[model samples]
Every structure is written in structure tokens, then in C-alpha cells.
Target: MSWVLGLSGLYHDSAAVLLHDGRVVAAASEERFSRVKHDAGLPVQATRWCLAHAGITMADVTHVTWYEKPLRKFERMLVSQVANFPRSASAFRRGTFNWLTEKLWVKAAIVKELGVAPARVLFSDHHQSHAASAFYASPYAEAAVLTVDGVGEWATTSLYRGGPGGLELLGEVLFPDSIGLVYSAFTAYLGFQVNDGEYKVMGMAAYGEPRFVDEVRKVLRPREDGAFDVDLSYVSYHWSADQSYTRRLEELLGPARFPGSGFDPTTAEGKRYADIAASVQRVTEDALVAIANVLHARTGLDTLCLAGGVALNSVANRALLTRGPFARLFVQPAAGDAGGAMGAALWTWHEVMGNPRTLDTPVLPGPGLGQAWDDATIGALLTDLRVKHEVLAPDTVAVRAAADIVEGRVLGWVQGRFEWGPRALGHRSILADPRRADMKDRINARIKYRELFRPFAPSVCAGAEGRYFDVPPGGEQLAEWMLLVAPVTTDDFPATTHADGTARLHVVHAAANPLYHALLTEVGRLTGHPVVLNTSFNLKGEPIVSSPVQALATFFRSGLDVLYLGAHRVEQTGSYDG
Candidate 1:
């Protein structure tokens, strides 16, 4: 059996995945263990965790693969900097220094970090990694693959055809013409962090009309063949690292929103910003739909696999499924740079190593591929911490937790393995009553401490999805990974429903997560609905908790009313009313 270790980081969302005999054993992001939000390091901690989880050492690994080619990325940076020359002097200086000092020698860095041989390390193209992550993990014999993201080497977007053999690159759109960057630029214009706040912009879009759609179109133009281009004069990302948009953008779209400023939807300026966000969201969805349609027409394949940062936009994903020609869609849960690790490993095993595809082994083993602690370990930790807690019977924990939710109490629920992706798929999640209108605000302000407009998602029983959500016929899988948004059938669950009456839904299957499924079933028995508000279990600007220690710390620090760690339960004792 061959073991492949894959790493993606140094840019953003650093992560590691261990593939044993072409099947994933463990995967996790560095940020989760490092306690940093989007840690951009070598992911040493994550690497160690993956190896330990697989009971293997670095020396036992057959190969180590990186998500992208550093030299190629440096070449792209040099070309961009040289083209802009004097205008990019400062940015170029920083980029060159970083690359020369660290980034360019990624293979050596990985070797040094892993203590592995130089020849053991390999590299894959950025978009190819994304494509491989999606297509290889999908349950398809053949499919059309689409990957879109902020500049990777030179390609920002790429299309591929994948089957039992391997993936073939079909076409690509180079940098400075990216839908991801365009959306991120708008995210910055709306006074939010560029890479971190795109989701916030998607949430804010639901509150307003697309009044500035024409203005945004001037910045991003879509063609009949599903290809698109950006007006570079308005974009400053190519030359300037500090600013994504130039003065020309401000002149066309009015003044940009101030970062960290308070936003009230009732105010005119706030409403204007929402309108701009709505315009960007609409244009982005349209462009993605156009691209999907073109890929479907070109490949003549009914199934589509999407990956990269742009694929994280659940709203745009739903639009593609409903409006595009593809009959089925599959999106890897961690469709961002973190997923590139898995892709690189798969690419090395099947494509570069000339190994045949194994149809029987599933590419992805659900999202719980991270660390897990058994009941004995959790109980020992609780005792060590001297925290007030109770051990309940296995069958009663879910019912008790569901009762807390029905009584309008916020809970931190941690069980089994940690999730391998961005979304908290029951393993590490905060649970709350979805029927309360103010539940969203309460959790946002007291627990998450995030923006007011940011929305919460819902996790419902699999078969009961259509009873509350307008999920399309083939959308069940997408919903299972929380990759699609659908309109709410009724306004009963206001907290989970966004302003547009849509919710990013997760359809939970009992076979995949029996405990979470039982909890939802109990919720249904009490409230006549099988859905609950679910979000990541961590404070703002922190990664999701991966251990019982981190879970307890967050529970006490935040306004969570209760915490369920395995079969043990801990309730807040003080008068900390939220």
C-alpha cells in the first residue's frame, strides 16, 4: 500500500490530507489546530495530525505532493510586476522577497518540514489540483469539470473532462479576468476582508435589489460562449497588493464603504451597499451559469463537478443547477484552496504515477475525516478540566440536546470526528431553535460576534428536505454537503431563512451521521419540524474547535447555554444571560 501526503498553504487556508492506498484516511486545515483564521503557513500541525491519525510517519509516506508549482507562480508574479514596472515597485519588491526567501523553494520546504527525501515531493498545477479534487472525489464515471478561483499561477478559471483514466484540461481563462477576483473586489468595496468576506457579501445581497447590475456589468462582461472578461482599468489587483479596485471604480460606482464601519439596513448608505452587493451576486451567478452551459454543450456530459474558491458560493451553485444544462452537479465540501491538498494527492496517484482508478473505493468518506476522541478520552478531559458535566446514556443525549434547542437555548454540539471542510456538518456545530425570528441576531451578536446581515444555515433530515425547501430533483447530494441554496417552502423558520427567503441547507442522512439525525428527529417530534439552525462551533476569527479542550474553552467564553461533548453534557452555571 502506498501512502500520499498532500499539502496546500503558504497562500491561504493551509491544509493537509493523508491518502492511504488512494483512499482518504484523514484531512484537516492548519487553522483548526493553530487557532488562527485562515493560517497561511506550511501546515505543520495539520500534517502531523493527519500522519498520526493514519498511524504512519513521514518516512512511511510514499510521496508528498504540493497543490501548485511555486516556480510557475513566481513566474506569473514576475511577469505581472514587470509589465506594471514602476507602478508595481513596492508590491513587486515584497512579492520577490517572499518568493526568493521562501515561496519558490516549496519542495525543499516540504522536504525539510516532513524530513522526507527531495524526490518524494511533487507539484501539481493550481487549477489542475482543484479539478482533480472535484472530479476524482465525485461519484461519476465521466463528467465535465469546472474550476474558478482568484489567480492560480496564470489560470484563474479552467475546464476539464474527467473519466476513469484521468482529467484532461479543456480550456482556461488567465488572470486579470476572474469572476472570483471581481466578487472579492466587491467584497473589499463593501468594507470587508477580501478573501474572508465574500460570503458576507452573498448574505448582504439578499436584502436588496440589483439596482447596480448594469454598472457591475461594465466591470465584468460575459460572452455568448460562457467566457468572461474584466475591465482591467477598474481592477488594481494585477499591480497593487493593497487595493483591488482603482479610483476609476469609485468614480463609476460611487465611494467605497469604510472598513469596520457600522451597517444598518434601514439607512440609505447601507441600502446602497446592499444593492451593489446584490448586483455583484447576480452578475457572478449569470457568468457561472453561462460557463456551465458552455461546458455542458461542449462536453456533452450531463454530470458536472465544480471546485475552487468560486464554487463555495452556494447561491451561484443553485443558480447553475436550475438554470444551466447540467442534469447533476457535485461540489466537494471544501471547494476552496484547502481542497487542493486532496486533489494534489489524487492527481499524483492516478495521473502521474500511472495507477488505475479504483471504482470501489469512494473518493470522499463524508466530511468527518478529521480528529475524533472516544467517550473515555472525552470523559477524562472533562474530569481533568474540573468542568461541571453529566454523562448521559447514548440514546438519551440526542433527545436531551434536542429538548434544549426546543427550549430556546444555544448549544455547542461536538461528536465523533471533526469535519474536513468549512461547514460545520453536525460534528462541530452550534445548534439553536430555527423558529425564533431573533435567533439569528442572538447567535451572531452573542456567540459568533459577526456581522448582523450574515445568515445561519439549517440542517434537515434528508427525505424531509422537500417538505420545507424547494430542492430540485437532483439537488439532494448538493444539499447533503450544504453546497446549494433553495427557497424556504414556508416562513416558519425565520432564523434559518435569509432575507430572500432562501437557506443554505444541509440534508443529513442517518447512515452518515446517526446521532445528528436522531437529534433532528427528536426536534421534529417536539416542534413538528426536523430542522435546526446550525453554524460552526467557534468564536469569530477562530477556526472550528477540533478537540474537547477547545470546545469547552469556546463554550464558556461565548454565550452558549450548553455543550455536548460525546455522551457528556456541560451546562453554564453562572447568570450569563444572553
Candidate 2:
């Protein structure tokens, strides 16, 4: 009975994973438990929840694994900051203070915080953890692995071969030449936060043409060897902390977009920004495709397991698959730094313990791997909150929810367990009829209060994806987890389709989430389309609600017409009007 507690934190997207004898039982991000967006703390709340959910304590853990090699990471930072000299004084001060105060003692902190023996604590390389999280968790017995992120210790991008033997490094692209960093630099230049706002750039790209590709090529150009080069003169992310790009970038790409000013594509300035975003997105896709070509040539494998923050770019993922040589892709659902927690645990289980990998796990294992509450517990909480609600029979919960959707009501859904990844699958999602012309505006303006260009996703029944979306044949697993964008083939569901005629598709299967699949079935029976607009269940700038109390607060504060909480239903007329 080997129990491994894997952890990743202190940078961003901190998370915890509990693996029972190498089988992932529970995994969640600290942001979900702490109600903080991109929480970078120790993930104490998440760790405790994983242990409690697994019915174990730290004493039962056989090993505690950390995702990053701190000393090597610090060394990279120290050397780079020194090389940049007086220009990096501010970043150096902040980095040195953080390292000396807390990050330097992460191993000791993990031991003391979890009460694990000193010998039980182990550390894995950042990229290796990313690779392991994707390959080991994938259904593939063997595959080509590619991990690309802003920076991990020193490696920015790495290629590996995964088999029963173990993960073997084939080649790597070192720091400062990172595709992820180049994209993030453009993200900041376009008036968005680096890690948090990269997706916004992806969304904005769809609105404009790739008119600035030549200018973007100046920032990051692909070499004939399939490696890309980033010009440091145009970027400051290597040393500076506050700013990601230098003045040279602004001179080359025009003025940076102001952060708070509204984004309207009709305006010339907005159009310019959109063009820049489109150019960068195109360049990013080209870079990834080139790298994938190289990896495929080296490994000559048909299946690819992709991991890290860069893999979260669904649009690029689709382009990479269609343009590159790989026939299949199994992207880790939680591909950000948070997923490294799972990787660390699985790496120790397979590579360290010499256990054989299995094919029992499906590629699209559902996102219902987090905390959950039953009808009885939720009903009690609703009662305690003095909120008006009705508890429905188990069988009719989905039926009533489907009826509401058919009646053009925006519903809040809280069924089964919360999701493990960033995107809300069916579990904790805001549901609305995709066929409604005003659905996107109503949800984005009234409920989400987000940018209009930011598109909502579509959650389609597994078999119904091809009816509306042209999902590529080799990208089923990626589509299943909402990790890739596919063209929308139908005009019936306009809300989920983006300006570029594609949607970030999430495929729901009955075996993984029977309740969600049942709800979709009922929807299909009612409206003849099992698809619906699905987005995370929270307002902008906040983490998704984890508990019933948080869900209730969000329900009343937003323009949700009804709430489907567990087996209970609370409508707008039931003394709870937003």
C-alpha cells in the first residue's frame, strides 16, 4: 500500500494530488479551495482536502514528492539576473528576498507542513514532472512527449520518448528561447497579465487577421533546424519582473494596448491590437508545428503526449495536430503548473518504484476528480442559509434542468463533484441554450461581466461532437478535455462558435459523468441538440466556487435564472432574484 502525496506551488497555479498505489484518487488546485485566482501558496487547504477525501493522514503517506528542483531553478535565476546586471536590480532584489525567505527552504517546509520524514521527501525536475503528468496519466503504452512552458529550472522546451522502460529525454530547448515566454511577452504587450491573460490573447486573436506576422517573426523566428529563436532585445522577461517587453518591442509592434480601456474591434486601435494578437497566435502555432515536426522525426511515433502551460493553447493545439506529423495527441487535462503535482507523484510511482505502466486508464478521464457533496448535505446547507429551494427526486433533476434550458432560462449547474482543471466541464458550470442568439451577450454582459470577444465553450455529448464540430480524427482525447479548438460545422448553435468559426470543444461521455450526460440527453430530447454553452461557474476575476455556500452567493449576485444544486432546484421566482 504505497501512498504518494505530490505537490506543486510557490510560483503559480499551486495544487495537490493524492495517488493511492499510483492510481490518481483525488487532485485539485489551491485556487479552487482558497477562492483565490491562481493561488501560489503552499496549497495547504487543497492538501488537507485530498487527504480527507482519501480518508488518510500524512502518517499514511509513504512518500512526498515536489515538482520543482528549487536549487537549480534558483541558480538559473541568479545567473541570468547577474548577467543582466544593474538593469535587473529590481528583479534581483525581489527574487533574492523571496528565495532567502521561503522558496529556498521549500523541502523543509513540505516536511514540516505535512509532518513527513525527511527521507520521504523527494524532488523531480520541472519538465520531467510535466512529461510524466501527460504520459503516465495517458492511455498510451508508449508515445512521444513534448513539454513547452515559459521556464522550468533551465529548460523551456523538451522532447522525450515514453514507454514501459521510462521517460527518456531526446532533446531540449533551453531557457530564453521559450515559445511560451514569447507568447506571454506578447500577452503583456497587448495589455494583459502574463500567465493569467494568455488565454485572453488567444480569444482576441480570432477577431482580426494575421497582418503583423512579419513583425512578430522579428520577435520569435523559427530556424531551419525546427528550433525557434527569441530576440532578447525586444523582451525584458528574462530579468525584469514588472514588465515583460522592452521599448524595442513597442517600437517594432506599435504602442501597447492600454489595460482598462474597452476593447472594440470596430475601432482602429482595437483592430491594430487584434491584428497583433492574430499575428502572434499564428506565429505560435507555426513554432509549435515546427517543434512537433522535429520531435516526430526524432521519435518517429504516431502518438504524442503534450504537457505544460503552452499545451493549454487549444487553438495552437488544433493547428499543431493538423499541420504536424503526429496522428494522435493526449494532452493532460490540467496542463499548467498545477498539473505538475500529479506528474511528480506518477513519476515516483513508475520511474522510481519500477512499476509497469498500464492502459486501463482512458485518455479522457472525466474532470470529476475533486470534492463533492450529496443532495442531503447541500439541502442542509441551503436550509441553513435560509435560501428558498426545492429538493427534486433523483431521477427528475436533469429533466427539470433541461426544461428550464428549453424555456430560455440561464441555469447554474452544480452536480456530482467539482472539476479538477481550469475549464468547468459539466460539474460546476453555467449552462444556457446555445441556439439562442442573445445567449452569449446575456451571459457575458449580465452574468460573467467579461470581455465580449471572450467566447464561451460548448459541452457536447461524446458522439454528437461531429454533428456540430469538425473535430479532427486524431484529436478525440484533446477534444474530450476541451484542450483543442475545432471548426463549428453547424449554424444552429451560434453562441458557442467563435468569430473564427471554431469552438473550444468539451466532449462529455456517459461513463465518466452519467448525470451530465443524462442532462444532455434530456436537452437533446427537448431541443434536438445535446450541446449547450458551458463556462466556469463564477464571476470574472474569481475562482470557481467549491462549496454550496459559495455557489449560493454567486447565484444570487449574478443574473442566473435558476440554480440546479445537487438534486435541489432554486428558481428566480423563489424569493431569490438577482
Candidate 3:
């Protein structure tokens, strides 16, 4: 059997995936194994895990696919920096060092790291991989594909058509104008880290009004053609080397907020920032709608596939599904750079190796490709640690956890295999009653301990989704893997709905995961509501809690009421008496 290894590395969210005979055997991100938040390096630990999980050695890997062609990226960098002249000098130096030292030699580096010959290595364009990951892993036969992210060589945005026949790139928006960069620029201007903090901006946007929507429109204007340009005069990314935010952004939005400075959401400045965020979010949605319309008109395809960091915006995703022209949609669970690893492998299988695509309904079974521990294994660990625990029969664990949640008890639920991407799904989740308005604040203060304004997602039963959400599960568009957001029906589940009446909902089906489905069913029976507030089972500034020890630590450190690990249950006796 032939085997292929795909890699996306030397950047934030580095990852590796192994495909044996065109089937995905294993996939993981460097952050999970390295214990670093968004570690940007060769995924050595992750690669080793994937190989070991597949019961193979590096020698068995017949092909190695690099996520992006570096030489083309170098060309784009040279031209863009030259266009900016001396203003881009510092960025040019940093880019040159990074590329010359490591990125440009990605193929050789992969060979050296894997102890394989360089001849086995192949490469694909950055956006091609993104597009492949979206379409190949989706359950659609014929679909319009869109990939958007920060500069990918020269192309920031690309549209494609894919199906059993083949995949083809239809249109592209080149660099110097990117929605992702514009969002990142504002992310930095708001005193948050760039790649890591964009979501925070998304979360924070809910608190602000879109009053500045008109002002933002002055700089970011959409074109009649699906492609649009950012007014460079209102931005300065081309000139800066050390920072992501431009001076123009500060001038437009007022002085940058100090990174740690406290700003009450009720204040004028905070409202202004919120308005800007809402405005940007609106513009992004408009661009996506415009692009989707163009792709639909060109391809006449009813289904669409989305990838890239921007695709992670569940709000925008919901808009694309309901408001846009597409009748169906699919998004990769790990749509960020980490997903590039999966994209590279799939691209190799379908594009370079010339394998035909399939219209399989279950493109991805679930995002649970990382790790799993049975009750026996968990029992052994609990015994070794001398931790207090109760081992319930498999039939009763889900029911018990559901009852606890309905009773307003916070629970650390770790079941089955871990999820593949950033989201915890049902496997590694901290759950609570969504009907309780206080649940959000309590989670933010006790468990998440992050920004209070940030909202929590709801994990709901697939069957009951129609009652709670205004939008039906996309037929093939079900977010079995928590990739899409939809409007919550105000009459059904008001607590989970955001200020805009939207809920980032996960539609869980029984076939994909029986245990999680059973738990949600029990929760529905108890509370008369199928929804529960779900977040990753980890403390602030850490990867999703992986091990039993981590779950326990977070349970104790945070104010969680109980932890349901596999068939075992650990409940908090009382608050930390210290």
C-alpha cells in the first residue's frame, strides 16, 4: 500500500497528517504535542504520533507533500516589498531571513526531518491545499470552493470548482488587498495578538454597535466583480517590520488601546471599537456573499466548500449559508493553517496523484482523530494518581452527566477520542445549562477566565436543531464538526443566542457519536431544552486539556462542579477551601 505524509509548518498552528492508501490514518497539530500555544515549527512530535498511530515507519511514506511552494512566495514577497520601496525594508529583512533560513528549503527540511529522500517530496500552492482540504473532506459531489486567509504567496483569496471529474481554480484575488490582513490589522490595533487574537475580536464585536460601519466603508469597499481592494492609504502593513497594526489604523480608530488596559464595554471608546469590529465583520460577510454569488453564477453549483482562517468565522459562515446564494455549504473543522496539513495530503491524493473524488455523505466521521482512552485506561490512571472517582456503567454515565448539567452543575466531559481541531466538540468539553443567563458569566469567570464579553457555543441534538435554530442543518451542511454558526430561534433557546440572535451550534447525530448523542438527548429530557453551553476543557493560555490529569487540574483550579471522564465521574465536594 502506498502512503503519503502532508505537512504545514514553520508557522503558527503547525501540523502533520498521514494518509495510508488514500485514507486518513492520523492527524495532529504541533501545539497539542509541544504544549505551546500555536507553536510554529516542524511538527516533530505530531509526525511521530501520526506514524506510530498508523503502525508504520518513515520509510513506508511513499510521498511527502509540502503545503505551499516557497519559491513562488519568495517571488511575491520580493515584488510587494519593492513596490513599497524603503518603507518595506524591515519587513523585507525579516522575510528574507525567515525564507532563506527555513521556509524556502521546506522540501529539504521535510526530507531531513523524516529521514527520507528529497525525491519523494512534492509541493502544492498554499490556496490549492486549502481548497482541497475543504472540498475533499466535504460530503458534496459538485461544489464551489473558496479559500481565504492572510497572504498565501500572492493569492489571498481564491475560488474553485470541484467534483468527481476534477478540481479547477476559477478566480483569485491577489495580495496587497486581503480581508484577513485587514482583520488582523484591526486585531493588533485593538491591542490583541494577531493570529491568536482575531477570534477575541470576533467575540468582542458583539458588545459594540456597528456605528463606525460607514467610516470603515470608506477604506474597505467591495467591487462589482467578486474581488475587492483595500485602500492602502488607510493602512500601513507594507511599511512595518516589527508590528502588524499600521499607523493609519490608529489614526482612523483613535490611539491603540494598551494591551492590558481595562475598558468597560459601556464606555464611549469601547463602544467605538466595538462598532468598528461589527462594521468589519459586516464588510467581511458582504465580501464572502459577493464572492459566493460570483462563484455560483460561474459554476452553477448549489454546494460550496470553504477553508482558511477567515472561514473559521462562524458568524460569517452562517451568513454565507442563509443569506448567500449557495444552497449547501461545508467547512473544514481546522480551517486555519493547521488544516493545511490535511489539505496537502488530500491535494496529493486527488489532484497530483489523479484519484477521483467521491460524493460520500460522511466525508469526515468526526473531528476525533487525536487520542482516546477507554474506561480501563482511565481507571488505571485514576488509581495510580490516588484520585477520588466513581466508575459508572457505560449505560448510565451519559444520563448522569446530563442530569448534573440540567441541575445547573458545571461538568468536565471527556469521552471517546479527542477532536482534531481547535474545537473540543463533545469529547473534550466543559458543559453547562444554556438556559441560564448566568452560565456564560460563570464560565468566563471560573473556567475560561478570559474576556467576559466572549460568548459560549451550544452543543445541541441534530433532531432538535430545527426547534432551537431558525436555519435547518444544511442537509449535507450539518456541522457534525462545529464549523458553522446559525441563528438561534429566540422563542426556543434565547440564552445561547448572541445579541444578534445567533448561536454557534454543533449538530450532533447518533451515528457519528452515540455517547454524545445520548447525553444531549438526556439533557433535552431534563431541561426541556436540547442546548448546553460548551467550551474546551482547559484553562486560559493552554491547549485543550488532553490528559486525565489536565481535566482534573482544570476541574480543581477552575470552579467546575464535576468531571465525567469516560465512564468515571469526579465531582467537586466544595469550593477550594484554601
> Which prediction has the highest lDDT against the true structure?
1
Give the clashing pairs for model 1: none
Model 3 C-alpha lDDT versus the unseen true structure: 0.81
Angstrom error of the Cα, residue 541, model 3: value is 2.2
Model 3 lDDT per residue over 279-320, tens place: 888888888898989999999988888999999888788788
> Which is better, 1 or 3, measured by TM-score?
1
Candidate 1: tens digits of C-alpha lDDT, residues 197-283: 998899999988899999999999988778999998988889988999999999998999999998887899989999999999999
TM-score of 1: 0.98
| TM-score for predicted model 2 compared with the true structure | 0.98
Tell me the spans in candidate 3 whose CA falls farther than 4 Å from its real position: 472-478, 491-495, 573-578
Which lDDT value does model 1 have at 529? Answer: 96
Worst 10 residues of 3 by lDDT: 471-480
Off by over 4 Å in 2: 361-365, 573-578
lDDT (Cα, tens digit) per residue for candidate 2, span 1-578 = 98898899999999999998778888999998888899989888899999999899899998889998999999999999999999999999998999999899998898888787999899999999999999999988889999999999999999999988999999999988999999999998898888899999999999999999999999998899999899999999999989989999999978999876689999999999999999999999999999999999998899999999999999999998899899999888899899999999999998888778767764235688889998889988877777788889999988998889889999999987788888888889999999988999999999988888899999989899889999887999888788989999999988888998999999988987898888899999988999888999999899988888888889888999999989999876665422
The global C-alpha lDDT for each of the candidates, from Candidate 1 onward, is 0.91, 0.90, 0.81
RMSD of each candidate? 1.8, 1.4, 2.3
